[model samples]
Target chain A: MNLQVVYCNHQTAELDIRERLAFATSDQLSNAYEYLRSHFPQTELVLLSTCNRVELYTAQESQDDAPSHQDIAHFFSDFHEIPLTDFFDDLLERTGPDAVRHLFQVVSSVDSMVLGEPQIVSQVKEAYRTATEYEACGPLTHALFQGAIRVSSRVRTETGLTEGRVSIASVAVGEFGKSIFDRFDDKTVLVIGAGEMAEETLRYLSNEGVRRINIVNRSPDRARALAERWPGAQVHAYEKLEELLVGADVIVSTTGSEKPIVSVGQFSRIRRNHLDKPVFILDLGAPRDFEPGIGQIDDGVFLYDIDDLETTCEQNRIARGTEVERALEIIDDETDRFMREIYHRATGPIVKRLREQWHDISQTEVRSLKSKLGHLGNDDLKAIERSMERLVNKLLHPPLEALKDEAREGTPHGLLDALKRLFHIKD
Target chain B: MVNVNVICFLASYSVVLIMELMRLLGRSPVRRTIMLLFGTAGFAAHTLYLMNRSNQANLPPLLSSSHDWLLVLAWISILMYLFLTTIDRNLAIGLFVIPLVLFLIAAAYFVSDSSMPVLNVSNLRDAQQAALRRWVMLHASLLVFGIAGVIVGLVLSLMYLVQHRRLKHKQTMQRGLRLPSLAVLSRWNWWAVIISVPLLTLGLATGFGVAFLSDEAVPVSMADPVIMIYGVAWAVMAAFFAWLLTTRRPAGKQVAWMTIWAFGFLLVTLVGLQVLAGSGLDSFHAGGTRDSSGLV
Candidate 1:
């Protein structure tokens, strides 16, 4: 089995590079799958494209069909219409056990900018689901992603990595929102989208004691649904967005719109009444629901996009470096356990056949000896058969131990081939 | 049993403060537990020392002397600290509350540990002195609880400002300096100001009542400059307390700032008076105080 990953993350590349390279939508991802299939038909792929990183994981049954780092890079270059040289230095590659470990680390959030964030796990799960939907994933990729998610849970349970501030909502509110306002109970929290992200940010806000919540969306039913989950949260029509925006002390917009929903002119008008009163705006949208210029509308307008929070996230990462180390330790252990299982799966058929072949030969020899020594006492024949069985078991132990040991690092392909030829074992 | 002096409990509080500072570097359950243990041990030693002092002086800790009075204040503050910490280990109330405790214990050293003038009220008739002593106890008791409220207000205000600054700056809650929510702290601070200022007023009124009740031999008169200074400090607090109640829309930051000033002035005046009166620099109080250290 061959496993490989090519990726560019926040640590390796800037946001612009990642955003350009990301498969932003399901349609785009499905198209990427089509392109990948045409290029590496024998390979299984799982592409994870988030705002922070764009990663492509591939696995193959035959080593010959395993695409090189350069091939994946070329695919990114060609699909995005950017030259390979433009991002070749930024693209990183991991193969075999290293690839397996990387996915585990990513899923566990040890590799995330925010060390213990839970969003990465869901993002990875969603990526895997998309891959399966497009028929891009096979047994190898399926097993890899599934193991990655399972290890993610272990890392969370065994380590303190997931203890505090584990989401963008918590980080934004706990870090920025708390800093901006003296108290949340008196503040107005306006959520502009009725999506999961909006609900998540609201959860953090409510935890901080924000009572007056105004959830406005294009769909009134969606807004009502989200409002119902939290008490004291009011639903408003999308037309009343400006009124809600002006009233909100802390505004978190996560609309799934493609372009900027709030332009500088629109927010400038909203700020007429709230010039001195500070407004903390968290634009968690991918394409950005609010224009970047809205951040500079005034000194009172404290605007933060997802990328703006990287510095705060990095500080959180350093603060919890020990938790990261402990989480990584679990990930490493789980990775090895997973790799050993895959290796055992590969070597199981051959090992079973070899054991059956040797046992059959021992039985035949015992039978023939029993017949030849028919003149001897029956007890003597039985004793001789037991001794022959022990002799065969002793002979098989060394090679079998060697095969098991070799399977630790990887499939013992060379040793298995030699054993098959030497023992007349057929698979 | 060995004697546990003020220094013993003071040292314990110092160690708790140091450990609280260390908690700011990172969150550690062991560190928090160790700090609380030291705090508890310190409180035990403090209790022992106060009981010893009160027994030796033949008075309650509050009525014993200026030194014991300060320790009593620190003791109640520590009690509140322990209760808050027990409820929420993450509440970092100690980071704000413990320094005041340490200061009170240390300040006890500078003030006179001698028995109050009422203790040495030998010149007055036995019945008159006895009545004066009861009034003095009521005065100190009211002041101890009331001043506890002042210190609480001051701590709450500081917490409010720090929490506000962190929230405004968009910084993570500094590692272990977690405080109560602003709403809770503000409400507590408001109550601290409102409740404490009145208790302090009644305490002052009782002190004046003692003046009128006692004869000239003890020399506790309302005309004294020390009494006048306390009256002025009371006015400062009263004015702020009134505003806190009347303000239609009280901004937490504004209220917190004014509370810091009002409570801060009250503490300084109270301690300044004790220090001055302890030194026998012509400062005024009830009867005649004998400096146990005989420093004068």
Candidate 2:
């Protein structure tokens, strides 16, 4: 059995290259799998594409028929309509044990941008499920993926990497919100857009003792739904944002707009009304909800965006480097152990057929001897048969033991061929 | 069974503070164990010290000398710190409480050692003497509790600033220094202010009653610097309390910062004036008559 992976990750490629090469949606992944099956009919494939990395794992029973890195790169070129020269150098390849270990690391989140994030494991599971739905996975791919998930579970259970400050929101609130305010219970929390990020931030704030919560969204139903979920929270129309700003101590904005929702002039006018009371604004929107210049309005107002959180998250990631090393070592050891077990299973049929052939010849000889010695006493005849059978068993033990021991390293293909010739065993 | 001294507990708390600092680097079970051991040891010694002082003075710690009185305040803070830290080992409350403990202990060194004179007269009314003693005890108790509230408010404010800074800088919470959420801290700060102002008002009222009772014989003046300083501290606290009660629109952070400044000023003035009085720098002690038996 041969297992291989052709991939590009944060370490090997820039974000732009990864984005360009990524299978962005489930539909895209299904199309990629169809193309892979057409091009390499004998191989089993699973495609895992996430924001941080894009990996293609393939396994086949015949080593000679395994797809090359160039063939996979051409698949990407053909499917995405991007020339192979554009990103061929950025792609990396690993085969055999290394491929297995890489999948383990990816599933365990050791290779994630956020070292111990829980999202990558789910992403890997989804990718495998998608591949299975497309009939792209066989026995080898199934075993490999299952082993990777189990290893990931073991790593999480054994390590303290996920013990504290695990979420981006927790870090943001702990690092920035506490620094800006002396207390939270009395603070007015203004949530803009009522998105998931807004809810996450609000939950953290609510635990901090925020008594008043104001949720503003363009959709009144969304605002009311969010407000209804949290006690002491009030829903307001989007137009009341300026009025809410006048009383708000902390502002969390997460909208799905393509442009900044709050301009500099609008925020400055609100700031003038709020005066010396410090306001902490967390802009989690992709296109930036509040104008960047609002951060420069006054010292009293503290603003943070997604990129600002990266530096601190990176520092935390660095701190867990030792844990990452430990997780990787475990993955490496498990991969080797698993591969050895797989190789041992592969040698089972040949060993069984050889033993059956030897036993059959011994049985035929014993029956003939018994028939010829019919006049002898029953005990004497039985003793002779037993002695002959013991001789046959002893002779068979050594070769089988050697073959079993050799399978530990790999398939032992050369040793198996030699055994077939020496024993005159037929296919 | 070795006898523990104030120095022993003081040293223990100091070590605990160091452990708290070490926790900022990384989480360690050994460090946590050592911190708990030292904290518990310090609390035991602190209890013994207060008991010893109370027994020696033949009065409750609050009614004892100012030195014992200050020690009682420190004891309350330590109790709070121990309770909080015990429940949540991850909280870095020692960093906030330890410095306050050290300050209180240091201030205890400069406070007057002489006890409040217990006036005893056979011919005078027994009911009046009992009332006077009760009033004095009430006055001392109210002030201690009020001052304890101030300490809590100040600590919460400090925690708020630290938490805010971490959030603004986008720094993650260190493993061992986790603080209460902003909402919780703010609520506690509000409670601290609300509870403290009433206690302080009662303390001031009882003090005035004691002064009025003494005016018949002692020519006590309200313009005394100690009285004036205390009056100013009371006024500042009262103003803050009024603002808190009346202003429905103040932000929690605004209130937290205001509480910090207000409580900070009160603490400095109250401790400063006491130290000044003990140092014999004020006009009240300039006479050098050594009438340490005066009621006011």
Candidate 3:
């Protein structure tokens, strides 16, 4: 059996290249699986697409049948309508033990942008499930994915990598929100958009006892939906955002608009209405939702944008990197151990078949000797059978030991072939 | 049983405070155990010392002389510290409380050690003298408890500030220095202010009542150094309490800082007045022998 992973991740590719090559939707992923199955009919396929990386993991009974790095890149190029020349150099490939180790690292979040994030494991599980639903996974793919999940769980339990603030929302609230307000229950939380970042931030705030949550989005239905999901939260149209801002103690803006949603003048008016109560504004938008000057309005107004949280997240990332290394080491060791076990399991049947055939030949020879020499009694014949069996076992021990030892590195295919030929053992 | 002295407990607490400070550097289970043992030993010694003083004075520690009175206040604070620290081994209360205990004991050195004249329950005692003694005990007890509350307020405010800073910086709780949540600390601070102010007002009122009841002796006048300074400290705390209650949006940090300033002023004035009064200053004398009545 063979396992392989061909992909480019945050480590190997720039963000722009990854974004261009990424399968961003479930439809795209399903189509990619179709293309993979069409190209390599015998190979099992599971495609993992996240913001940080895009990896295609495939397994097969023979290495030759497994899709190559070029095949996967061409599939991406054809599926996404991107030129092969654009990302061909950025693509990286791992096979055999390396591929298994890479998958283990990915599932364990060792390969994630935020080390120890729990989201990646679930994402991997979803990818595997999707592949299975598409009839793309076989026994090798199933076992590999299951092993990856188990390894991820073990790594999380055994290491301290998951102990601290490992998410953007957690860092934002912890670093900025707590600095602005003493208690969240007494504060009004205004979520500006219904994006995932907003949802994540709201989740953290709600956990901190924020009773009053207001969602203001351009899409009122989405806003209403998000607000309805969380208890005690209310949804408002985007037009009432300024009025909501006046009452909010914490404002989290993550709208996808290209320009600033709230300007200094608008916030200044809101600040006047609210008096000098400290308001924590977390602008999680890319192009900046709240104007830069809003942060400078007064001492009571504290504004933290994506860039500010980025610095803190980076610091935390650095601080936790040592633990990440430790976790990665654990994954590496476990991957090697798992691969060795799989190799041993693969070689087991052939080894058993060879041993049985040799033993049968020895038994027949012992019977012929006992029958030809009538001087031997029943006890003596039994003694000869035991002696012949011991000779056959001793003679077979060296090559079997060598094959098992070679299995540690990988499947000892060459040695097994030689054993089958020499022992005249049929498949 | 070996007789535990003030020095034995004072030294033990001092060592414990130092050990608590060491936790800021790093955590060690051995160090924590040692700190707990020393704290318990100090508390035992403090209790023994108060018991001895109460026994000698033939009065409750709160009704004894100003020296023993202040020690009683310190003893109460130490009890609170020990109770809280024992329950939450991670609390850094010892760092804030032990110093106050040390200051109380240190301030005791300058105050009068002579027991206040006991109120005679027998018929031979003068009505006015008995009345004066009872009023004095009441005044001292109220003031002790009031000051104890102030000490608690001060510590809670300090804790609020520390917790606020840590939360603001997004630092994880240090291994041995767990603090109360902001909500809990704020609630406790509010209670401390609410309770302390009334007790302090009563203590002041009782002081005035005692002065008025004693007609034969010159009453404690407003001009008296101790009385004047204490009044000023009370006014400061009263103003702080007013702001605390009146302001709808005062930050916890602001409240904490105000409490620190006001309570800190009261402590300094209370201790300073006692020390100044002990120097036999004629400016503080009311009607009794300057050597006999002042401070003690």
Best by TM-score: 1
Q: What would the per-residue lDDT of candidate 3 be over residues A1-427, giving only the tens digit for each residue?
A: 8888889988889999999888888788878887888899999999999989998998887777877788888898988889999889888889888999999988998877778788999999999999999999998888889999999987776655654465578977765566445579888889999999999898999888999998899999889889888999998878888788888888999999999999999888878755547678889999999999987776567677887777667665665576677688888888888888789878998889988898889988987897799998899989988999899999889988999888987988888788889878787
Tens digits of lDDT, candidate 2, B1-296:
23545577778889988988897776666787898899888888888877876776677888767767777888899899889888887788889988999898777676675565433323436777677668778888999999999999999989977876665455666655778766577778889999999999999999888666544534457787887888898999999999998987566668878998899999988877767767674533122222332111
Models 1 onward score TM values of 0.60, 0.58, 0.60
Using TM-score as the yardstick, the better of models 2 and 3 is 3
- DockQ of each model against the real complex? 0.11, 0.18, 0.08
| Poorly placed runs, candidate 1 (over 4 Å) | A1-160, A174-188, A193-199, A203-242, A245-249, A254-308, A326-427, B123-125, B286-296
lDDT of each model, Cα atoms only? 0.82, 0.81, 0.80
Where in model 3 is the C-alpha error above 4 Å? A1-163, A174-187, A209-211, A219-225, A228-233, A257-259, A276-278, A291-302, A307-427, B117-131, B162-178, B181-184, B214-222, B249-251, B282-296
**Tens-digit lDDT track of model 1 for A6-102:** 9999999988889889998878888899999989999999999999899999999778999999999999998999988889999999988999999
User: In model 2 chain A, which range of ten residues has the least summed lDDT?
Assistant: A158-167
How far does residue B118 in candidate 3 sit from its true spot (Å)?
Answer: 7.7
Question: What is the Å distance of residue A261 in model 2 from its true position?
Answer: 5.3
* Alpha-carbon deviation at A137 in model 3, angstroms: 30
Cα displacement (angstroms), candidate 2, residue A260, comes to: 5.3
